[model samples]
Target: MSKLGESLRALRTRGFTPVAARSAARSFKGVLACKKGEISVKLTIYDWNFLSYPHIQVLERQDFLPELMPHVDVAGNLCYFAPGSVTLDRYNPATAILQCLDQATAILDRISLDPHYRVEDIQNEFPAHWEYGQLSLPWQVLLGEIKPNTIKASYFILEIGDKKQALISNTPGEATRLAGALGANFKPSHFQCWILRTKSLPAVPQKMPTTIKELFDWIKIWDHDLYGKVQNILSQRDYLKQSYMPFAIETPVGWLGFGFDLDRIRREAYSRDPKKYRQYLHMKGGSQGLFRMAIKEVSARFVHSRNLSYEDLQNKRVTVVGCGAIGSFVAQALVRLGAGTGERGILKIIDSDKLGPENLGRHALGFPSLFRHKTEALQEELLRQFPHGKIIGIASSAFEYKQLFDADLIIDATGEEAVSELLNGLRLARSSEVPVLHIWIRGNGEAVQALWTDSTGGACYRCLTIPDPNHHRKERFELLKNAPVLRTDGCRAFTPYAVSSPLHASALAIDMICSWLQGSPSPKFRTRSVEGADLYKLRNHDPSKLKSCPACDPT
Candidate 1:
């Protein structure tokens, strides 16, 4: 016997018996007859490969639990281990199997004794449980708010080219904004929907309710509030029709949908009396159809707030002074950080230069943008992918448009001395009206540095360039020994930084922006060195302002 097969022999004393498993080579299985107090469950250890988690399932086909059982699935599969949460000892396969068996039974024992834990566990993952219903749609997205008791729902049509996708949300106005962003003409949908949100969920069923009557029974037992509301709506006079009622439940996790049609259309011929209409709506036969649906949440609230931990730049007005290699990435990253995605948000780009074939090697834009103004091309490219951003492109100089400088934050990626000094003067000119973030590449991609200037008396952009006693404005803490060698293709000259330089600068800016949003943006300046670069000794501490310098220092 293999070392793992010998491990199975230990379970015999614990009422487990070995079983032949043709479940691929080097796999194992055994039926575990475990009894916790009065409750007994026969589970089988199915798949135990080095590649996957040990698949343990209840042995009897009829003993499978409901979808809402805590840590246990519909097929009686027990989830003992969360993937990537722990490192399994692949070296000791024998011990690993024994450990998994113990953990699986421990979960079973706890849920068997404590019913409240099972309720909370199911409610926490309610969306997943509700989706397993046989008649549910694949998924849905929302763009509207949901409140308890009231019914607010509608059907929307979204056309992405020739492919038309119909979906449901709470309001037509919010849905109109989302669908209109794709440049499609808006029209009302014929497929009407009704959404009823409830404060609590229904109790776990013996099996997922397949009939409308079974669902009503489950709701009556667990949720008195939802049951009361559903009763009042269905009891309305003369509103009874044979048409199917398509509706969704706005739960905490997400929306879950189910629909049922009335048999009155077929049965109405049997009865001409008004009292017979109520009798025709009864669900006595299995032929009374009941199916579930999916409500995919494509709403700004869910779509934008789901995965983010830090505050996104949703409603902030941001202006990019350059749309070159570094600024292109900065604009793209800012959009992803939720800039220009809110109702009052704005993302403006200003650059006088046009994109060339040579700029593509180190730029965020590509061949499609050749010869087009960099600001306009970046706007075109970004809007094609993320139409939610309110992007304005100006194919002109940043200095000429004085009103363009008005922003919540200005990102200067032009990397020019004249521009930095002018921006510093503007901060002083406007009494630090708005913060400016200047990010640039230095010494041929040796490092990328960024400085965030937000205070009136704090370190201005010119503080880094203040002249020393030797009459030369040098690095306060130098990291580079030699300057970047300027490269020329005979017509114009430019520094030949690699493609990775702007990306590094973008990463640095993103971290600084996070700190800025957190309201404690200390260590205002930051730098990152490229690995394996033959550079001088690094001096990367945050530098304060000079006391007697020219631009920012008091005279």
Candidate 2:
């Protein structure tokens, strides 16, 4: 006989009668009767390599008294071993089956006496198996974060068609009207809502009564105002017709909706005394009752956001210097990418220049921001779009800021050689390590370059410029050395690059910054540009450590 067959015969001898066996399926079904209760067990070998660690399920008497146990699901499958905790001898199938049967027998004995006995014995891992329904929201509604004690009135937009649905909105009247205009199949109802924000998402029952009385009793834990308002609203609708009550609630993760029916609940209440039911609906106290009810199941739909994972970027602190054309666009892109919002992270912008008419062509801010400091204008523009974002604009030169040393990452977009050199020095002198990125445009916006320096010894900004045999220092790029500088009125010489040129540079810089934040190994430098009449193009440069460098290696 096979080892598994011998094990089954041994189990039958021990009072575990085999009722059915499927040899092809590698499964055995049996029942064991004890003084406590009868438990029908099924053992199946899911993986031959791990034959000793077979999957065990209790077909009958699957649910214990309370039904909250780790390694066990509502369907009664017993996860005999915690995930990755299986230690069994693959060759000894008989001994493994006997051990599993012994454990299952002990579990049944304890559950028959007290279902919570095992839970009380093993406090850990119960939460992992806790029964709770989840509610998801599109965007994290502020209402969900509010305290329950805070008295506030909110509204919901119900989209009830083939399926019942709802969305939290600040503008209730407008949302209802808009839903009607969209030709939704169901009649819209104006709802007065209050959020019950809990540590865990509220547990919803599988079935809830659809009646005003039930809802009244459900929310009676709140103030009399809520109970009285709901009563008045439901009284206006047909007493006999089926009506749905749409309400909004807040959880730690997101918002939730409850679309309850009134007609069914009213029918259930017909057997009770009218006077008692009225008094029951008006009963008022503290939030204890509501808290208790929230622990159970409720009818809710989860509306999760597609961009929920992007919220992780809020943990990064980024500082951008020189809020000019490239800097402004980079700062805005970081905010849109979900930086500096959730945690202690922030996006600090430093610039001493003002938004003049000349900057309107390539700057992120428009004519409305003229005369405002570049940092302040960009900060305001970003806040208008992302109200919850953390942005600080400092109207000062990058050299004057002492807090740059504490930032997680720093980007220098001043396009000034002097400022880049100063920042490189400041970074090397700091006790705390901070990565620096130097971004600038070449002559006539023909090409742009971004040089990233790591905390460890690497190429600094000055490494890009080395003295030649004639003792004249020149940039590593050939185009920057030969391209003619555009001269304005007096000594005002600038590069005549179009607005599109800086935008391309901004995109390249932002890409490098994001990659670095995501833990990519920093490269020496990256450059990009389009082919033009002057054949102005800069290749990606990989510079070696300069022996006579001042920032990185000083004698």
Q: TM-score, each model?
A: 0.79, 0.51
Per-residue lDDT of 26 in model 2: 64
lDDT scores of the candidates, listed in order: 0.70, 0.60
Best by TM-score: 1
Q: Native-vs-model 1 lDDT? A: 0.70
Give the clashing residue pairs of candidate 2, or none: 203-296, 204-297, 204-298, 205-297, 205-298, 210-261, 210-262, 211-261, 211-262
Candidate 1 wrong stretches, greater than 4 Å: 1-29, 37-51, 59-68, 90-99, 133-151, 157-166, 170-188, 198-202, 235-242, 262-289, 468-471, 530-545, 548-554
Error of 1 at 73 (Å): 3.1
| lDDT, candidate 1, 36-102, per-residue tens | 4322344344444445666676544323323457666665667877886656676665677677778
RMSD of 2: 14.2
| Model 2, global lDDT | 0.60
Q: Residue-wise lDDT of candidate 2 within 1-555, one digit each (tens)?
A: 487677667666655555344464467677655456667877766565563467778777634333444455666677665556656665776676777777767666765676456544333332233222122212211122223364334334344566444334334443443345444443443544434443433232222223444455544543355556545544443322333334444444344444443335653464244333334334421111221112211111111113343233565788999899889988887776666665576889999989988788887889889998998888887866665567999999878887876687888988888999988887777634888888888767877788888666667788877757775666555554455468684666666778877788788887786676566635658877666536445566556768787677786
Q: Give the CA lDDT, 0 to 100, for residue 331 in model 1.
A: 89
